[model samples]
Target: MLRFNLLLCFLFLLPGKHLFAQNQTGKRYKIDRYNSIYLPLGEISFADKLVQFKVGNPPPIKKYRDSTQCLHEPNYRNYQTPNFISLGCGGTLTVAFTDNGFMNLPGDDLYIFEVGPSREAAKIEISQNGKEWVYAGKIAGGKSSIELSDAGIDNETVFYFLRITDLKELCRSISAGADIDAIGAINSVIKLTINADVLFDVAKYNLKETAKESLDSLAKIIKKVDKATILIEGHTDSDGDEISNLTLSKNRSISVKERLLKIFNNYEGYDFEVKAFGESTPRFPNDSDENKQLNRRVEITVLPPKDYYENLINK
Candidate 1:
């Protein structure tokens, strides 16, 4: 499930982590939100679409700038009420986005919708300033996606532009080229979390300098949330004396809250509450060092007020 949270709450896990089965404790899996690039902040430029590629009025580039990646889904065509077609043959299209470029990450996808009756082939390309373009490669009509690494281009290449060109020769009717519905700079949600060991020394609550970067990034996100309550939770493994463990958890949660306040105090419209679970809320048994490390952590959860949604809708 793609949660609307736009940023990762912690560093992402390695591949196959998503398939990991949950233990009997009922701990929900975390969603990855690190690399998400919000769309509606992009535009399609220098595009050509066949007359048949569009059902009625001239195709608007705006149609393909949304989050919808409706390919092969019959009910969704052209992205809007009118379906889409290709440029017949030799037609090309390009989309420019705000992100410096897409990253070379595992399971990344560039979604594109293809029209039917017949599948067609198309060439894809990437660019930095839009003036200089690089070959990305061919995309089959029905696959509905492209791999960023397939271009095998420099991972440093900041991708601001995407191009698709129809390859079919001998012009057919209309809709010969590739028809598109939407494209995304990213494909999944991102999560951000900091390991307790990394953020603090053993049995200590104060954050180390190494933890500053992560909290800085988190602070920016909190500011962006604008209006919301925050929940600062402190957790600990089943180690040391039980009373000390509970006190350590409380002090640690307070430490994080104080640091965040120093950074976010300038802003208004927000408040926070603090709580500590001690060893009672073990994500995993503290039978192993690794599990113990996992148990000792602090979490920040953004809580929008009850009327937050209602207020936005009424606005």
Candidate 2:
């Protein structure tokens, strides 16, 4: 009886083979064209079965995998220090030392330093005579700096110095050596000396050809410094009506600016400010020819803003 039941089961499985063969019939399939093989019906079969595995089913994967197949990483850590300066980089530095051997200036002469490799900590020091040194402070990375204003050194013919002290355990090694990359000293402020009489034509808003020489000199002074600004002021004698004088003075100031623009060829980054006082701010009583000449002229003064100058020094 058991053998008869087994035969019945085998017969039941035969129909499944016929069904799989029917599903694959008339289906043009190619596994590999280069090596073709025609598979006959009943040669392939399908089975539905339960799959079981031992321990170690994974907890849900927390991170997605990157499949780009690129194995290299960027080398961003090799970058080192960049160059910078505090005081003497963009412009010149002037130290005003009195005859008595002290810095008489009311403000600080601050400077910026670009710290470099060797990881050695550094400090700045100042010297009045270049013999004795006073410790300023520690300098870290780029833009670290010190100021001489709070040093309270005397205003005599003083010499300033910067000493870089290495504080790293291995001794800091920079691309540059231990010496300062630059050194500079400040000089006394030089006031512009202008003669108004030579600056313009008499009773006219135009600058005289003779005044070109003076204007050229003024331009030279301006070109010597960075971020310098100019103020062109116009004044007139009391000989004319007050209203006419005011208008003339204003025109004169404008004319000066125009001439400067022409002379400088309208430098893109530079600027000038123009103003007219007319007969308001007189240099003299305007009674004598000399006094009238002084009043009739236009004055051009070059001034740098305190903050801007300080920034230049500290940069």
Candidate 3:
């Protein structure tokens, strides 16, 4: 009888043990403000509950410690119903948010973090209804933590998230007041800014053999963000007559557009707007050879909506 009771006890506990292990499989971890990753030792949920440390204080750990020793912050930065996207690269991570999702905020803040081997860079963009994206500018860098505040977000569902493509290993934790949706506004612009002199034969509109390298880079950026309205703007130095310079710039810009279209032949439902400014927009003064070299350039700016630009600038 004693042996039988022991056997019964073993059977009863077996299922419970298995279930407990399974429950911990999908547990979320935190990457705290101090740039540490921590697992929760206590029960934690996002539903009206705050994450508190077992010892009642923020846990301190050595900088750049192993993942297991790191602790994450419990509270997430609050937003005014905006949408965002984040991307991580080698020792850096970037997060961007737009004001077109929840509350039509004008400016969106991009959060950048440098953790380990990755370096972070962020570009904040805006759109009227999340269907377009316009460049704002590069946000300030060199922070372990940042909050993208002061963007003019109105009461519309703003779309935002992160794009984490460059890093070998990536992980994240987000505490949001509102539910996150995967659906985002389709981007409609492809902008490319390349140093023209570096890409062409000297004093000629024709592309040098080495120019393909730059074009190849442009091709890659375009491939990642497919389906965009392409605007190709060509610029030239202030050396020759304005009319001749404009003509050369226009030809060069057209050449780039044609090559891109051929390379991305399979991408359908996209339009192209090719224009030549011809020495109109000089990136640098034409006083020296270096500056003149800089002046001869191409700019691919995606024209989203007016509100998109407004939001980006305001943010």
Candidate 4:
């Protein structure tokens, strides 16, 4: 059975709370925050979903098998408090970034917060889709960060899944293998999701009158960035005809792009791209009304500034 955090999983599914935007400071040379784009370390920035967890040959006791401990931010004390999960002798764990994904940054792209003094090692792999993975190097207990810069992946690609398999370097004590506190995508983009119901009327592509205020406020935040690429993607529920749904999704994305562009008409610091996935990319199954509502959304993804990234790469 796949172990997961019930509360954390439920909270992330709520509308407007799905994707978060990070607050970038300085020259974008260094981000002070972790996985979340909207909030800092104390907030909900880390991984939210625990896809798979298999205890190693000599697994830890039942108390340490609680996978929920690895859900949010890192909170492991130096052998004082037991706030992390143990991956047994040679167990494996896989996590999903439901809110944000990490991309190919110039520096380290991922950080694994581990506990214990033995410094157990785990082989790390990342994937855009959970089925196909790319070797992303390894992280020993203390040496917890890894870079995907040399992973032979396109810089524009973003990865959402991470699979960690213990190397079985150490198998002593109740908390065997690698003890994990949290996983962070250091080089990630800001994601903001808006519900389609709030943006438009049923079966219509025009912007709702009430949505202008929210969009305007959202634009104010986007305006603060020095330089970036903004992506607008539209999605729908599987309730309608596939072709019609695709067209609706496309039109809705264009509508949002037009409004945002008008807001940024005089500014040249941002570039925009639009995509429509229709019912192909649903956050939840469309069996219920609530799930359908969640599926119908317009996602706005903001990548880090190009100039800062290039400078960091050359450094």
Candidate 5:
């Protein structure tokens, strides 16, 4: 996970809107304040116009997605096996997804998942027309990412074909060459919010049974991307003592992180952090139980790989 430099703003009074906290170490944190946009939180696995895919022929014909254990389609929502287009030396796999052309974003535009720990390297290419190809770059098979911006594609330009040519040898069985679990996209998404009620039980830091299932799905989707930074923050209604409220919020966030860790513990390169906002920031007025419930929750924000934000500096 890449770190970004946030501007240091003081603990100014925004009244009921936001609050910043200072730790014993003198670092100011903003887990308590948030922008009230109507966006769903937790995980993001966006689906675009995916048309078709082809595996280079020694002919098992179909590859991973065809035999998917994914409970959901398009997004591949579940922690299934590395459903890849396993290729051997000189083998290739190609897919087509439409948005016209991938645009520039704070992060990658495409994500390709493969067997990890030991990875396979592949040559990547894109095409506006099936016959014409443009080399985007090379990707090593685990959770390899692609930003069309890095390939000189203009924003909003719709180029269709995504071709991955294998360049590595099979490490395990010969049939287990480059195992690709899934493919996804990245855009200008900087934050994702999940409703706390969906993740926790009332007055509990432990996840509900269903919440664990939901998080498992999210973990599968997110685990496909490389270099992810998971930030979990908890919030509460303004009913308890501020000190205790802070503790509750912190615990709740940690709860969510713990669930994710259950599924993601294998990815040692990813970063995870938990923070607390307590009752400082509320999404709705605490005028009723419904509003208070909305305020009392946890938030998870994933900062895309550092290369995502590097677009600004490169610009």
Candidate 6:
């Protein structure tokens, strides 16, 4: 079985929690011993790409109108700070975690760094792909966190994209709407995505011969990690019945895991886990052929070692 608690302490420490560990190199590391999530800011990974942005009817000043400002980590320190982007009333913005993503864990899975004192709120939604979204509730201005489990989403689900729409609750500030500094994943994972069509025939779980190259490349990447739990999740389109789709997804994930294990037979410092979501979690709606193809895929999430963030913080 996979250990979910192992990475919890390393990912995001509770409001006053702290962890200290010493590696073989006699180096001590600290993950997050600070107050709010923004303390670690640029040190750790956060949403990296700005996918889409639309200013509402009442736009913010030109200084705070740059959508790219919301990319990466939050840099807003005070009301006078200009590091964040302001979405006008009823504005919307979407961001992507290119290198890492968040999955449901013990507590809050995501956080929003919405600066200012107005307590502006935003309708927050999450997605595996950028198209289909799951309402994960709202972030009430300032620095707020939301648990993915609260939305009744699958624990095995990992989201790469996040969409935030300004509720226009408090548009009093000069920035208006919601001033977003950054979005961070509390339960973060290093993700690698591969289209299912590349690995199998139509509706089949068996790995095609062509999958060898992809798996080979994946294995090489996995070997580079010092220590981690590897999660192999399989997903499919909604063409088949629920049970059949679920079984197919499970077998597909198992197939991928088995192949990777063969290469890692003599390998150490890693634990492999498999999960299947079938049509339960679609990155995109199955209405179109292209979208269906996009939904049929596999996501490999690499949970960092217990001391992964510790090492990162120390660096």
Model 5 agreement with the true structure over 1-315: per-residue lDDT tens digits: 122222233333222122213211111111112311111111233223333444433433243434232111223222243343455444566665432123354445665554433577777787766578888776763436677778786663345566667664543443344555444444423344567778776667777788887787666555444455676778988886898988888888888887777665444535687889998988899999899888987765554445335544697
lDDT of 3 by residue, 1-315 (tens): 999999777754653223222323112233334553211111111111111112101111222112211112233232222222222122222223322111222232322222322223434444433345444333323332222234433332233433322222323322111111121222222245788876677568778888887887777655433223556888898988999988888888888887776665534433567788888878777899989877888876543334334444676
- Each candidate structure's TM-score, on Cα atoms with residue i matched to residue i, is 0.41, 0.39, 0.42, 0.59, 0.40, 0.61
lDDT of 6 at 113: 74
Q: Which stretches of candidate 3 lie over 4 Å from their true place?
A: 1-190, 302-315
lDDT of 1 by residue, 203-306 (tens): 89888888777787887755443444567888899989888898889998888888887666534445677988888888798999999999898877554433
User: Model 1 reaches what TM-score against the true structure?
Assistant: 0.41
RMSD to the true structure for each prediction, in A, is 17.1, 35.1, 19.2, 10.7, 17.9, 10.6
- Clash total of candidate 5: 12
Q: Give the TM-score of candidate 4.
A: 0.59
Model 1 error, position 14 (Å): 39
Show model 2 residue runs off by greater than 4 Å: 1-196, 305-315
Candidate 2 lDDT tens digits, 1-315? 999999777754653223222223111122122322121111110111111111111211111111110011111112131222112111111222221121234343433222224222345565554457776555454433344554554543234333444333322122222212222222222234355567665667677788788777776655444333566777787887888888888987897788777666665434578788789978789889888776676766544334445544586
lDDT of 4 by residue, 139-253 (tens): 8746777778766666766788898898998887788888887877666566788999999999899999998887887787665454567889999999889999999999999
Over 4 Å off, model 4: 1-44, 190-258, 261-300, 305-315
lDDT of each: 0.54, 0.43, 0.43, 0.76, 0.55, 0.76
Better of 1 and 5 by lDDT: 5
- Model 2 scores a C-alpha lDDT of 0.43
